[model samples]
Target chain A: MISSKWVVLVIYAMEDGPVRYGEFSRRIEGISKKMLTQTLRQLERDGLIERDIHPTVPPAVEYRLTALGESLLPFMRQLKTWAAANLPLVEAARTRFDAQSLAE
Target chain B: MISSKWVVLVIYAMEDGPVRYGEFSRRIEGISKKMLTQTLRQLERDGLIERDIHPTVPPAVEYRLTALGESLLPFMRQLKTWAAANLPLVEAARTRFDAQSLAE
Candidate 1:
């Protein structure tokens, strides 16, 4: 669950506060509506996010991170930083490993 | 890749340095051999781990975190800390959300 891209990005997108369903989908590019809905429901179930439903014409739905979810932000930011810093090294390692395999 | 349990634990198990294949399996409870193998291959492909094969009667296979993988440990530890601290809150949120769903 912690390793899920949709879960991570959904939580990331909502970190700034309430986000509508449409905006959420747009923020996480290449995500299907079905996948977006699934991730939202799962995140909500896990108590990481809150869904707000308004009594308007078509009904407004927005998501915000819960206190629990907010607590995870610093950690997420750290992971993001670590990944960014090591991406080049990781890529180089992959290239070396792949070439070694092809040679063997 | 980052979200895989086997990947996390496999990496976690090696935080202390190199570990044999058997030790890796034992360290992470409930992971199947097939899944473990797959995770190892994927992690190696991504340059997060290195697999050392030694010449022995049956050959020795040990896994160790790459420099890139080691760089991720601090971030991983932070994540573990956050998860521990917020677990109760997350669980409570889940309970409330579940009850609400049942009622709806």
Candidate 2:
């Protein structure tokens, strides 16, 4: 499986203490609802994320990282930094590619 | 786009100079033919990987990284090292999760 998606999901889910499904979906751009739900379920099943459902007139659910998920923060931070720094180059490559393909 | 897959594709394509489609496919495990073709097309469109077509009795195509693609090697290496080192922990978490779920 592509771990980068999981990494991004983990990072975004833990940005704040705990996040509701809608809040989590809004925070991470470009992720389909299906994918977000699938990822969350996988993470929960893996024990990296915990889902707590409140028992009330209206049920509310929240997700938070477990200790295991917390351990991935440093690595995620490193990846984020690397991606931010190098994104320009990748974008440039894309532009050059477009120009060349147009010429062809 | 998930750059990790691109990173892996670039690394595997450039592992030993230029690689043919079949050779590239064989090297990267778990990638479907459709995904591999899709990835290669995307990479080519982005100019990170160059595809060379040979005119022969049986047409042959090869892929190699451009200079931009080579620059990604360092980042890929870092990710590989991180994954290799941390994979055991992730596996352990999976086992723990499975056991706990079984118990529950």
Candidate 3:
């Protein structure tokens, strides 16, 4: 569970800088609030992300990648690049194959 | 849907030669038979895998990568390398954090 989404989410979220919960949720589309919280907690638990809280009246918390999380950025970037470049070809293949199947 | 799992499955399955459905399932460990069939169909549809049917007394079907699928191998290998190397640290971080949470 954590292995799947956290890798992508953590990399994506931390690419900018220290992000608040709302900011993190907004960046990764389709992740539910509950799942975003879960992923954040898991990442913090796993030492990939650090949660910082300010001592103030309201409350401020921000999340940033630890050394370990930063290490994974290259690999995640590679995956994202591959996905973006090849998606069209893959989609074309699907369309052709589906048409062939329907014909048969 | 297909993009997520199919990438990993096709890469893992095609590391060897043309694989049968059963062999592919066995190698992946946790994927259900239904999901395996679905993934294979998706890959075939996507033009990443080619299904070869042999003319024999019974029936023989094998799957191999098309030119596109072969192109993804290097990127997948990088991801696999990163995961295997970092899993231990990630697991250790989880343990330390969990212990800290319990103490607090």
Highest lDDT, which number? 1
The global C-alpha lDDT for each of the candidates, from Candidate 1 onward, is: 0.82, 0.71, 0.76
RMSD of 3: 3.0
User: In candidate 3, what are the lDDT values of residues B22-93, reduced to their tens digit?
Assistant: 677678878887777887887788777899888875778889988887877776777678678888988898
Q: Tens digits of per-residue lDDT for model 2 on A1-104?
A: 23556556655568558887778767787888887888887677655678899886588888998776676676567657756876787688778888887999
lDDT of 3 at B23: 78
lDDT of 1 at A15: 76
Q: Write the per-residue lDDT of candidate 1 for residues A1-104, one digit (tens) a residue.
A: 56586787888887788999989767889899998998898888888888899989999998898787888888777767776887787788779878988999
Ordered list by lDDT, greatest first: 1, 3, 2
Mark the regions of model 1 whose C-alpha exceeds 4 Å error after superposition: A98-104
In candidate 2, stretches whose alpha carbon ends up further than 4 angstroms from where it belongs are A3-10, A30-32, A54-59, A85-104, B3-10, B13-16, B54-60, B86-104
For residues B40-87, write the lDDT of model 1, one tens digit per residue. Answer: 988898888888998997999998987878877887677667777877
Candidate closer to the true structure by lDDT (higher is better), 2 or 3: 3
Candidate 2: the clashing residue pairs are none
List, residue by residue over B1-104, the lDDT tens digit for candidate 2.
44456447546568568888888667777878887887887777655688899997699998898876676666567657756766676677778778887998
CA shift at B28, candidate 1, in angstroms? Answer: 1.0
Model 3: interface root-mean-square deviation in Å: 3.7
**On a 0 to 1 DockQ scale, where is model 1?**
0.72
